[model samples]
Target: MQEWWRSAVIYQVYPRSYQDTTGNGVGDLAGITRRLDHIAALGVDCIWLSPFFASPQADMGYDISDYLSVDPLFGDMADFDALIAGAHEHGLKVIVDQVLSHTSDQHAWFKQSRSSRTNDKADWYVWADPQPDGSPPNNWPSNFGGPAWEFDPQRGQYYLQNFLAAQPDLNFHNPDVADAILETCKFWLDRGLDGFRLDTVNYYFHDQQLRSNPPSQTKQKEILTEVYGMQEHVYNKTRPENLGFLARLRALTDQYDDIMMVGEVGEEGRRSIEIMGEYTAGSARLHMAYSFAMLSDDFSAAHLRDCIEGFQTGAPDGHPYWSFSNHDVVRHVSRWGAHAVSEESMARLTCAMLMSFEGTIGIYQGEELGQTETELVYEELTDPPAIRFWPGVKGRDGCRTPMVWEKHAPNAGFSTSKPWLPVKAPQATRAVDQQGADGIMAHYKEMIAYRKSNPALSRGKTTFITLPEPLLAFTRTAEEQTLTCIFNLSADQHIVSLKTKAKVALGEAVSLEDDKLTLAGNGYAYLSHGAEVPL
Candidate 1:
């Protein structure tokens, strides 16, 4: 098999927010097909569509109602096929998201399961009896808010819901459920899709015992989003049974040539990296797995080193997929701007740093334009988290705004009519067309090209070098190729001395003098071996 995904940079497209051709206040699959050339021009190898499956839109398209059908909001089967064919025509692979862990309350399977206990599909979704007091089965909390289990009068029991109550978790404990989902994968594979971005891959199987999660030692008072971090999450998710399920998924994908799978392991810090390792540890699992570790506010050199090293230690043979921002979180430029010289400088720096890492790369849309988080008022909110806890947790709505393509076009060129999500001035100012002359957009193209042109960056062993504060440095060594990469993680100019003679392989916004590299705030560089630092 080609293993083309090993080093390919995957670009994620949030379909409802990408582009709108229907003028129905939303983006559809046809919109994506129309913009295929834009994605190809970005130099990415693949496009990972968020979720266009038949959904009720409770959590955007994450709450799927039908595994094989595209939601009417995003177009139908014909539009999806056109997207796949068009992407391939542009030399870009297509990786659609698979939300197998759960489905919308309106799904036929869930509906059938809730109607009666004796039905053949009754056990298809996770269901349990409430305690004598009529409370939820256990202490499991939903990622959105409130109890993770919802009481259902129809079945006289509580159903498990890790996210919105509208999105019920599937009962992977059922062999029939596993078989059904696998068949769903076959449906897409038969449609000629290249790969899958497995949504909540680690959340597929919960502990059979349904143990209560213990409270964390650290109090979570930051925002509503951080409340879930207070639990140990020992049983509700990250189960061992998931490994077996992943193997089945891998085996199915192997049946098709060059097909790949990258799981989204939703965890933080150590546990996140460990799961990424375990999921991609062998040939019978995912090709790569990404965690929320890199999607956090941690920008220190030590933190970056620990995240990568943690994965390496957990599974020596495992591969990783790294990203700074996605549809689920704030844009990295805005999230990390507190320590940056400026959004433009920091955005470019993050791009270079991400490419230099020893794994595959995933870029969310609008990031290359140095886009910031849009400030949405209470009325503009659609994401569940923000709705429940307003000012405390802004939710993901700000990040899910429509992509700004034109400077003066109606609706910022995202749609001819009003967009499903509003496109505010702050975000629209960083429009794709407006940034073409200079700035982060141009830098991203250069950085991605640089990473692709150099084999060492995409397919090399990475070694982190200990340096003083604010300077993250590492070297990538592959067969007959070697390159050193350095980044300034702070908004203060600092210079560091390099022990080895380095040739300027690729650099800007920094200078070298007699082995001393001077990096302005947010500057970065890539250098090759055997050349003296410029004097």
Candidate 2:
């Protein structure tokens, strides 16, 4: 059977923002089920739901307290089953976010592990003795802030805390810990789950020696103001031992039919691509992987070419998943607005570009409406970074605001009561009900249909075509089909002389006459490269 995920497009639903049915101001599983038609209408093959598992809400639902149970805030187990059934009925595969890297401090396992050194679960978490000077074991910095270790008076030792203090990293080196995590994953798969979007997949293991990371050679900072960007991060994460656990995960998923796992590589630049290659290079590891490469602020053709070519050279056998927006980052339409004619045009351009790429695609909620980030004051912020560092950092709350379903309804129809995160005017203006036939939503549906209709665009090998600074071009070939994709990644129009005569397959603001093509700002086109034209 053909693997469903290779050519699939995934729609991500942030449960807290998708829809709220109980009027408690938070979205639930029933709300997702209620909105199944909206997702199915997009013509996507699958839906990836963000974490709705049991948690203390410390780091949202990422700090999973119980992997096996549904969070009461989202609904009960019956609600989850109904959602799964509803999605399947819509002909959409359901894949949930699996955060196995860490657990909340309130988790029963963490409580037992931290209580005493002799307990059965004592070694379940990474624990280390402080230096004789009463300091942390090493010089590792947390991804959030401060040291990566937290003091525990009861154990007289520090535990590794990769993110917030409430989240403790698990010890994957222990066989039992690995077994238990795999079993949790199996529980979900057994319940008719299509697969998982493994959160921070490269962070599963750390160096057994607990060595301090060296200073970064490239000094490539994810967040320049943060201390975590200063180190090369060879020890704390992206460890070689992570591959073993990934193989184990693959073995478990392999037991089920047509199950797929796509990992989220939490690295930057070429290193991120390299890790993506390693993690998905073989059938024994991740089926596919994605990184933050395309999610950055760099929107130039040169940057886009470099990322695609770098991945093609590094991981020829591995498959990649690409996305421009998600729960954690700024919306791409706003991030790349400087290079576009307008928000709607930019959204249409990206929809065309991402659809023509060579692997699986992920679309976040509200992206179909060309949604921009919501502006918020410090008083309305709920994200940790924004709360901790007020004016200096605008946390993820801007992107995590409630999704808008209605144009003029209260809270933009996301919830009946006040939402967990407020929905402002800018976002509410682009509600689903507001989109017309020629709007961004229609453009998305059109491009998705175009991609599915062309086999070369969906399942073909990519070859970059050299073009001018503001123009990016590539060819995708499979079997007897070939397509040339060209894009003008600037806010200025340019006309280029085509080397050969080819008819336009799908695109906007470009025509072929006397071997010439004109592309307006942010305009893109797919040209038939061979004699066999795609209908």
Candidate 3:
């Protein structure tokens, strides 16, 4: 089989918000099956579904309770089988989210392990003795809030929880735990899964010594959205031993044909890009990996260039998957709107930039419509962190709202009844049916088609061209084609002199005259040129 993922575009489906066929106010497997055509029409090679597995709904299915079964809230086994079959029939590979780093407190394995000091699975999870004063094992803080260790009175110890207290970190230091998780992965592979979107891939292992983490040197203004960022996370996660487990997981997937895994590097800054490079450094680890580098609020040319170039320099042998939005964070259109003339223009510019990047790409649900973040109040909040932190952190529920399909239909055609997350007027106004023939959706389709048709854009090596602020330029060179991509990142128009003659292959508000290229606010140009020519 070929390495199709190297150039593939994957569409992420937040199942709970995609479509609701059950009339139960939530999206399910059958809902996804019925919506396969919608995704296929977008020309994405694969659909990466967030977790629909058996869970207590804590952390929105990330805290898996059963590795081999589906949650009743989503559907039964038959529904999943039908959804998989439907996706394949539409020429789309189906990959499900796999949360291997941790499990729900209700999982049978965690229950058994916590029941006794010496049960058969006692060491399946990371557990430690308390300090002399009954404090947590160390100073590690949970990504959500508070201490990272939860007191387990039954076991008379504290368990490591990098995220919510309900989601306990697994002990990969124990070989048995690794073997068991691998077997769980095999169960899905046997059922004909395309691959997996490994959740928190770098958190699979922790320092065995349980040493306290040192204070982060990060500037106070640059701290992340959680207390966890206050320290340099050395002992709790991203350990060196994580690579071995990734290799083993890769070995499992290699047994199946045409399978690929894309891991989520749950990190930030240059370290996030570095971890992405490390995780996907070779065929022995993840097929490709993505980081939060592009998901941040930084909208400058220097920041974007640093992210792409950082990955290239860090791991020349590794591959990357890039995205501007996902289930997490605010939508790109709203987050970067300040830098654009309009939300629609920002949407068009980001699409063009993302499609031209030299790697696999992913687009979240509703992204094609230039969807903006939902303005929600405290009463409508569902995300754990937002609920706990309140006004300090608005959380991700805004972006996880239902997909608006019909302009006038109830709940915007997402469901017959109300959705778990409200579909407000601002978001509903941008419904799929309301989009014009030449609108944002059409632009997305056009950009995706353009990327796929051009060999240089799809399968090319990237070489950045030094440019001043507000101007980003790069060349994608494939054996058959070479294209120079230039973008005006600001809301004001700019003109640049081209060094060589070129034809405009694709662009907006852009004109080529003589040797001058004029780009409007948020405009971009893809200029076709010869490899021998420099522009």
Highest lDDT: give the candidate number.
Answer: 3
Give TM-scores for every candidate, taking all chains together and pairing residue i with residue i. 0.97, 0.97, 0.98
* Candidate 1's TM-score: 0.97
Instruction: Score each candidate by Cα lDDT.
Output: 0.89, 0.90, 0.91
Candidate scoring better on TM-score of 2 and 3: 3
lDDT of 2 by residue, 1-535 (tens): 5699999999999999999999999999999999999999999999999999999998889999999999999999999999999999999999999999999998999999999999999999999999999999999988888899999999999999898999999999999999999999999999899999999998989989999999988746466458777889999999989999999999998899999999999988778888888999968999999999999989988888787777787888888999999999999999898998988889999999999999999999999999998889989988887788778788899888999999799999999899999989999999999999999999999999888888898898888877787988888988978999989888889887776678888888676776778888888888885522121
Local accuracy of candidate 3 as per-residue lDDT tens digits, 339-369: 9999889999999999999999999999999
The best candidate in terms of TM-score: 3
Candidate 3 local accuracy as lDDT?
0.91
Tell me the tens digit of each residue's lDDT in model 1 across 1-535. 7799989999999999998888998988999999888889889999999999888899998999999898888889999989999999999999999999999999999999999999999999999999999998899988888889999999999999999999999999999999999999999999999989999999999987888999976656665345687799889998889999999999999999999899999887888998898999979999999999998988899899899999989979988899999999999999999988888888888999998998899999998888899888999899888988888888998888999998788889999887877888878788987886567788888889988888889798987777877788877988978888888899998887876667677876899877888888998889887432212
Per-candidate Cα RMSD to the true structure, in Å, reads 1.9, 2.2, 1.4
Give the Å shift of residue 422 in candidate 3: 0.2
Ranking by TM-score: 3, 2, 1
Candidate ordering by lDDT (highest first): 3, 2, 1
Assess the local accuracy of residue 515 in candidate 2 as a C-alpha lDDT between 0 and 100: 74
